[model samples]
Target: MASRLTQARNRVVDRMVNAPRDTDERALRRAVAGKTVLVTGASFGLGEATARTLARHGAIVLAVARTAERLDELVAAIEAEGGKAYAYPADLSDFDSIGPLADKMIAEHGGIDIVINNAGKSMRRSLDLQYDRFHDFTRMVNVNYLGPVRLLLAVLPHMRERGSGQIVNVSTIGVRIPPGPRWGVYQSTKGAFDIWLRSIAPEIKVDGIDVSTIYMTLIYTRMSAPTPSMRKLPGMSAKEASGLVTRAIIGREREITPWWVTPAQATDAVARGAVTWGMGILHRNSSDTASARGEAVR
Candidate 1:
């Protein structure tokens, strides 16, 4: 019975997050063929799948990640499949290094046609436990917000000069949903970028550069592995999530979110007070349970 329920939930989730229709690979190929695209966090998960998919569709994929070895393997695999790819390993969190990396990419590729800001960090530690761990907030903001912004600032000029480009930000649904306990760090950082991108979208559009933000839900990836409680929850696969990114690339939509997200956001806003109170109670219960466990261990 539990297995059946899980399967049903998975089906619902798949429908919610998956693209409204199957992407025509032929169309994707035509859109990206011979274009240079940059994908961050390309070592694994959604980024890896996106890089592979874009490369297969004839894009010159510049795969960037911290893992040089894994990126080399990805590039080699793409090459073996007759796809064009170049692995560029760099730590996104290292703010000082971004400018040089951008220069190198521009020099090599002449300019990027598309940029997928998919690199980010996720945290789920309770606020109570993070009382002394301020680094949690800083780290997340650096990687999730600052890193992407810096990279964009570095590349935006080049895109502007060409008078054509696309920027796809892989955001999270948490930005639109009610603020949840234990996710303050993650949500805030993601929210920062979401707002930043929205504010700049119109301005960039004037320069003929399209901007897209995909408010992705839970996806099965290494970043989501730490939250064991979420393991059984309905989530999209990395490949499915990658397809949505590709859809955004081809369609050039301003925003892509789950079909149910609008209603959920409306409900959350309407019941804000009650939701906050209930979340407070849940937080207290979680804290009490943890204290009890500590006592039992002692």
Candidate 2:
């Protein structure tokens, strides 16, 4: 009886997985018409959705990710739908490889009109764990902070020469809230990117190159397997986030997000203690879930 129930649940999950592909929720025809866009981490989650949307709208997309198979699949899907795309596989964690990666893309498709620096690392770890796992913090910064900076450096020269470009650095809302008990490594690394982008935005603004930092809320993605409370809170869909991203790139918006962001930022400023306490409650629940899952895997 238990096995039969498990099989039934698996079948339901399979149906949900297959449903999105069969009926085409792709607004690809309208979103990216006549744009050349570069999306980092295009193998999965938000990056993949943005890449697909841009392609469907008639933009030529350059998709980069560490996973070759996923990139290949995305490229094939775009081509099958009568859109243009180029896939490049290079791990964002390796900053040294960024120069050649940019060169290859330019050689293949010319320079991009917009760059989405959306590739990042996110791991939730307690402060107590950091002493033994400082490498997690180091790696996170290398990929999340340094990688995007290097890519910007490489691509900006072409964009400047052409006299127009946009870069959307996909940071997170975690910097505002500092919601913790975990994410000591993740938050610090992403915070570094946010600060650096703000500092450098002024210098680049004069060149017709707009640098926009997008602080995102929880989105529906495989990586965003949140606790019950977070799941209950209103989360952004990848599709909705893609719309905001498109608006920022095409219109050169200074910043883009849902209206909730203003209040979230204010709460962080005036009542940090209360917010941290609230996060503690959530993290406690998350830790138990992670532990149980870890034990089951073992």
Candidate 3:
């Protein structure tokens, strides 16, 4: 009975959070065919799916990730399907390496037509557990903020000079909703990049560059797998998440937020105090994960 009740709640939450999006394959082909597209985090989950879909539509995919073997496998799989892809294995968290990676891509491809900033890191640890781990904050900031920014800075000039490009940021819906406890590092880092991109969108618009931010909701992947509670929640599949990303590629919408988010944002604005109090109560009742508390999983 308890399990059934949990499942029922998950269904309700999924319905409220997930929105249906239609993608016209013809449109996607028209937008990306023969174009050089770069996808970060392409070794697994959503990014991997998105890269494959884009390649199927005839995009010349540049798959970027830290795992060389996985990236090679992804490229091989794309090739087997008569798609074009090249593996570029690099760590997005390493700020020093991003410039060289971007430069090499530019040098090799002449200039990229689309950039999918899909790489990210997520953490959910409370402040008490974080006091001894300053690197946690730095790691998230590096992966979620500075790294993407550095890559963009490297490629923006080339895109600007050409006067045509597209940048799709695979951001989280957490940045849109009210702040919850234990997400301070992740949320703040993601929020910083979101704001930075929005601020620069106007300046780059005149250069014929389209900027799209997909504020995505939960999708079960390795990133969320470590959290036992996330496994019980209703979320998108890899294919479903990739569809929204490809839709963003086809339509170039400035922002693709869940339909429910706007109203939730409004409610959050008006009931800020109430929301804070409720979240505080919930946080107090919840204990940190074993990993967050620096303990063994077993």
Candidate 4:
């Protein structure tokens, strides 16, 4: 009954906050008409879903990813649906590769009104594995942290010059709710970027750029496939997450979605070691059930 009331209240709040008539997806999309957007990791998962959705909403979309093949498929999919999309293949980790990609987009479209930093990696190897396989941590940091920061640097100048832009970092809730033991490296790097963005928000806000850090929870995507427990829990779908992200970009909202994550973050912060210890127990228990054989902590 308590959960039911929470849902009812959440629905009412959603309607009030989003403006009931605009809560109709199409009307919400119309808010972004003629806007230009660039999404990283657009080859798959939430990134691809966001690109297609934004394109369908009359926003010009430039999709960037490392896999040329997957990106081509995304472009074709959006075009087939009568939406505008362009795919640019570039290894985001390679700083040299970003320039040309950004150049091409600016050349064709002038300047981007929104940028979604959605590229990331998830790792869950046993803590014992780090003794020799340190590359797992290094590679994850390079791909997930530095790569997005570099992309932001590349496009920021244009945004400053234009005096209007929105940047959304599709970060993970693990940074705050880190289950510990295995999440050190992944969350450490993710947390760094999350803080980095916050540090710059005040200065950038004056330049007409809205920077939002999104701490998302478990989602139904390829990234979540290895951790089998997500299937049983209430998880956000790629399309659903994408829709929330899109609304954030369009509405110029700060810290979008997983609205519940804020209280969870405060709990973790106030409890400190106690929170980590509790989460560690939750991790072990969730990973133990037979049904979660592959879904739990690996």
Candidate 5:
């Protein structure tokens, strides 16, 4: 009985968070056919999966990442499969280079029809451990927030001129859920971009430019590899997560979230104090355990 109840609960949760597993392949192909799509962090993980998926759907995928070799390989694989893709290697954290990159993309492809802001850095160290590492926070902010902002600013004029564009922000559930310990750097930076995107979404829609933010749950990706505990946790695969991006592209929805997310957000709002208290206890316990093992509490 207990096992059956657990199975049922999992099913409900899955339905709430997952994109419909059965996607209309032909429809998705038609939606992006001939469209020029830009995907950042395309060398690996979710970005890579999304890039390949978009390319397969007949989009002229512009794959961006820091690693030229990986990007080249990805583009080659896509082309071998009869899909259109181009490798553009650029360090997203380098704010000064974003404008030039945007220009090159526009000059080369006419303009990007969809921009997937999927590149970001994640940090999991506690604030106590970060006293000597201020760079952690700055790096997160630069990659997660400023990098996308600069790129978007550089490309907005072209999008506005065309009066049609879509910006899909790959966000995190941390932005909506109750905050967790040791995730201050990651969550704060992600939240900053989340709020900024939401603020500008209204203004852009008037010009026929759509902006969608996907508040994603944990995914099995290199980005989450640093936390060993996460490996054992139930998480989405990169391909599955990419499907949500494709769905956003097809549906042009304002926001995409796991079905249970709204209820979770409401609970977070109503039980803020309790949530904080519980997290505080968990943090304290974790610190104590580390101390007991004579290990640094990071």
Candidate 6:
């Protein structure tokens, strides 16, 4: 009875937070057929699902991530399904490697038609716990902000020369709404990339390159599994989240956010002080996780 109630409540929350999307599989297949689509963080979760779906629709999938074994497994699974895929293992946080990875992909694949910036790091440590752990800020910035930017710089020229392509940023809804406590590092880094991409969209659009940003809500994945609160909250499945990515690919829209974001943003704009104060109270009342305190998870 308790489990059923939880699921029923979650369904209600999911509907409220996740806007419905219509995706015609035929249209998605037609859009990506014979194109080279590169998906970062492709070894797991949303990235893995997106890469596999794109491949199924006839896209040549370039799956990128830090774990070589996982990437290999993902590629194998895709190919087993009779879809084309290749694995490229490299850490996004290692900024120096991004250029070479992009260059190799261009050389081997002959220029990618689509780029999905889905790789990211999520952190939720309080300011008190973060004071001594400055590397948290740097790691998040490197993975969430600078890494994607460097890869885009490397690939943008080829995209421009071709005069057609699409770039999708799988961003978080936290950037679109009022940021709560314990999400400073993650939200700020994501917001930085979000702003940067939007700022450059107009200039890039002149070259016929479409840039779409998906301000995605939470999804149940290994990345979110560690958070106790997240496990209790309603979220999309990996497959559902990947549908949004394919929607962006097919639609090429400027942004895909929840139905409630506009009003939430307005509320934040008007009552920022109150929001901040409330967040502060929440912070004061809550304690950091064991992992945030440099302790191992059992």
For 160-271, candidate 2 gives per-residue lDDT tens digits of: 8888878887878777654566766778889888898889888877888888766777776755663444566555567756765666565566665545556777887899
Better of 5 and 6 by TM-score: 6
Q: Which stretches of candidate 3 lie above 4 Å from their native place?
A: 1-15, 295-298
Q: Candidate 3: lDDT of 89? A: 95
Error of 3 at 197 (Å): 0.4
For every model shown, what is its TM-score relative to the native structure? 0.91, 0.81, 0.93, 0.84, 0.90, 0.94
Candidate 1 structure, TM-score to reference: 0.91
Winner of 1 and 4 under lDDT: 1
Cα lDDT over the full model 1: 0.86
Q: List candidate 4 segments past 4 Å from native.
A: 1-23, 257-259, 283-298
- What candidate 6 gets wrong by more than 4 Å, as runs, is 1-12, 295-298
Note each model's CA RMSD in angstroms.
Answer: 4.3, 7.1, 3.4, 5.0, 4.0, 2.4
Error of 3 at 102 (Å): 1.2
Worst lDDT run of 10 residues, candidate 5, spans 288-297
Residue pairs whose backbone atoms clash in candidate 1: none
Model-by-model lDDT, in order? 0.86, 0.75, 0.89, 0.75, 0.86, 0.90
lDDT tens readout by residue for model 4, 77-179? 8888887888888887788888777877888998888888888877765565567666777777787888888888888888999898888888887776534
Candidate achieving higher lDDT, 3 or 4: 3
Answer with 3 or 5, whichever has the higher lDDT.
3
Strongest candidate by TM-score: 6
User: Candidate 5: which stretches are off by over 4 Å?
Assistant: 1-13, 16-22, 287-298
Looking at model 3, the pairs that clash are none
Residue by residue across 149-188, what tens digits does model 5's lDDT show? 9999999899989999999999998888888998888999
User: Any idea how many clashes model 3 has?
Assistant: 0
